[model samples]
Target: MNSTHRKALINKLGKERYRTLINNDSFPSLPNDIKEAGLLKKQSNLDQVSHTSESKSRQISPTCAEIKSQQSSHLGAVDFASASTYEMNLESEVVQADVVHEQNPNYVSGNSLTFGDISVPISSCHPYQGFTKPDLRYPQGDDQEDSNITDAQEVFEHASLDGIAAIFKGLVCGAIRTTSPLADGLKPSKASVTTVFPPWGAVDCLLSLDICEASVEPLAAALFNATVKWAEKSLHIGFAGGASLTIPNSEVTLKGVRDEAIAQVFGSEIQQAIQQSRIRIQEMEKGKLTTDCVSMIITEKGAFISLSLGLVQGLEIQKKLYT
Candidate 1:
């Protein structure tokens, strides 16, 4: 359809999906204007307080292992400052001693396998771009001693997951401070959001949100809805999802010297692209271009989804949702 129709469709779908999202008590609440699918950003005094405390995040942690070690050692009565300083020097050396490849460009990591000297491996966790896929299969012969072989995909997935975990933990803990509807009274944390969720899409929604202004609940809930819909619909590579923001009408206006001239021009190619997406274009009234907003709401069995893009001030959801 035309850009006007396409924009209208986007506004309609965003509101509809969001409506079905927020009826649950667990989600953050928003004002009624959110029903219109207007994605505006909101700033509050609570948000500023959260930021001031976040600067000290690095000091917020005593890992479980550290706590257990301290308890086991019975060092609560001992002078920790002196003991820690001495122990830290030794531990620092041990941690630093693990470093390799400092000078040797051809150094191979223990997790990596290389053929002879050139950087090719029979099986490598790090696959070279554009090279043949690493052979992950191993012989299953029982005529001799049996040995285990690592699954390449599993190895890589685990390694990648460590990084995603750190990111998710930060997002969750940070959100607890900012948006949980009970954050200010709650103490800050130096941990991730929730691992209770699958976490497959945590990075996706977090990356889309503005950390300075965005809270954890709305985007996190959006992520949950997106993932749940992804599974329920059995969608692969994905379905129809796109969004557009409203720009000031003056953006299209020419330098009208005291109403001397006025015009609105936009790329017709965008309109052509939408029409090409198999959407019907029954009517394209020019005034509808300025109307810019419409919305729809879908309900699940005994569940409703309420979305508030406007509540997320300075929120920017990309046009394409990539798998």
Candidate 2:
């Protein structure tokens, strides 16, 4: 504690160390060996931390790859399921269409079955063939005549009028014979009358008389004129009343006849009724009536009259009976 001993310690230690030692501070200057050892320990800890971080990052890379692979597999499964469902739906639709087509043969492709009015396909209708009455003799004459009569009877039994024109012709003939005066007066001359079938499919009745004073030609001619007048008065009341009597109802009745004929030909399996009415109203308005021709030929023979009638009126009423 002498001044000399204190001055000697201060000189050995240095002024800053002396001040720290005097203050009794905890932090003191370390030796070089101890400081170097502490620095080495800190550097070793830093290296270990860096190596652990790299190892964790390496482990996380594999886990991320596995997660991405699972996500891609899930997406592929979903896409396959969607495609299968779409294909199943498409197949179901095709099967339904095939079933519908098999159920209805009349349902033509690209055409739907409609209950409303539709156009009639005239081309599809049967072609017209005129009526032909069998030639038969009541009493058997020779063997040949008997054979001929048998053949005629067979033909008559099998004959069928399958066309609109033939049906209309038969209607007119039946109506005139049943209701007109022409039938009564012309019965006597029926034996001598020649029936001609024109190439144009028209029926012509030709009557020729002898030039005798007692000949019934005048009465026949008078009866013929009277028959025409009767037809005009009775049938043409609401129809066209000129040489051509075209009744609007004629086509309608003919259509009904067509239905019946179709039924008979195609059987009950097919629909007998036409779904649509194909009436040509424009033809009616244009005054294009059905044609009928009557011609008189005066020659060495007494008198000749040929009558051809087409589309007679009042046939609609008769159609109801047959239908």
Candidate 3:
């Protein structure tokens, strides 16, 4: 189909699916523009608050043998200054030890292969390249056993997105203090915003959203569309069974001028991607689900599945119902 027609089909599909999704909710749905704006605002606020309290990551502690299994709890008021920092003593003799070879260049011994000094001409061999080029095949002695013998083909593939992810993570963490908004009751500083959602709060906030369960699909569809550009080229998106989404990209590139340009150019595509991927939305009238919210199951044309709830906690509930 023509690009315009294809876009129209996508819009039609999204609207039909979204309408169906809203019908499942007891609350009415808001106009598309309004819903988008609210989500954007919430996302912005979440980003700000998340950056402020950045260190509260979930930690895993392990107990072994007879020791009691300890349930992990969030610790308050961590002692930031109590950490002990040390410098490396690179010049110490222990650190400076190196291998020494006593064999002479011209020495040729009789027991070359059986047990005595085997003098090989130095001119026939190239010099070794530092510590990394270890001669693993050298028969040292009876104690020298080949410890590792795994095939090289088993090594997993790597991607360039790894660098991109690092850069994105750094930007979010590094710029957290600057990009926050300044307004009434709050200046646009990072710390003020952080009090609400600490750093990396997006994951938590998303999980907490009580979309009617139907709109989750649209949200996933949008996010999928947004993120799939890299996956389309780098790795296969795999979905093996019931409701799973996996995008094997090194990182989601959403930062700086490059990120901004991408968003500007591909905003609609991203949104549509999310809309198209949704598979199911929970019904609201059953009262089993939350109001003014829609959860959607987004699918990747048989590749994978993810959930996307509405923009805010109860936005669909707050809007008017359209029978």
Q: Which number leads on TM-score?
A: 2
List TM-scores for all candidates, in order: 0.12, 0.17, 0.14
Give, for candidate 2, the lowest lDDT window spanning 10 residues. Answer: 86-95
Which candidate, 2 or 3, has the higher lDDT? 2
Minimal lDDT window, size 10, model 1:
255-264
Candidate 2: give the clashing pairs.
none
For residues 1-323, write the lDDT of model 2, one tens digit per residue: 55556445544443221022233345343344344445545655665565446435433233444444454566432222112111011111110122323222121222221111222232332111221333466865589675664464310011112222233332122211121235557522112223222222223211121122223233222323211112332322122233433332221111112233323332232211111111222333555332113233333223343333222221221232223
CA shift of 104, model 3, Å: 9.4
- Report the Cα RMSD per candidate: 40.4, 35.7, 41.6
> In terms of TM-score, how similar is model 2 to the real structure?
0.17
Q: What is each predicted model's overall lDDT from 0 to 1?
A: 0.25, 0.28, 0.26
Writing each residue's lDDT as its tens digit, candidate 1 over 84-144 gives 2111111111111223333322222333332212232223422222234335799667543
Q: What local lDDT score does residue 140 receive in model 3, on the 0 to 100 scale?
A: 57
Candidate 2 regions with alpha-carbon error over 4 angstroms: 1-190, 199-292, 310-323
Question: What lDDT, from 0 to 1, does candidate 1 have?
Answer: 0.25
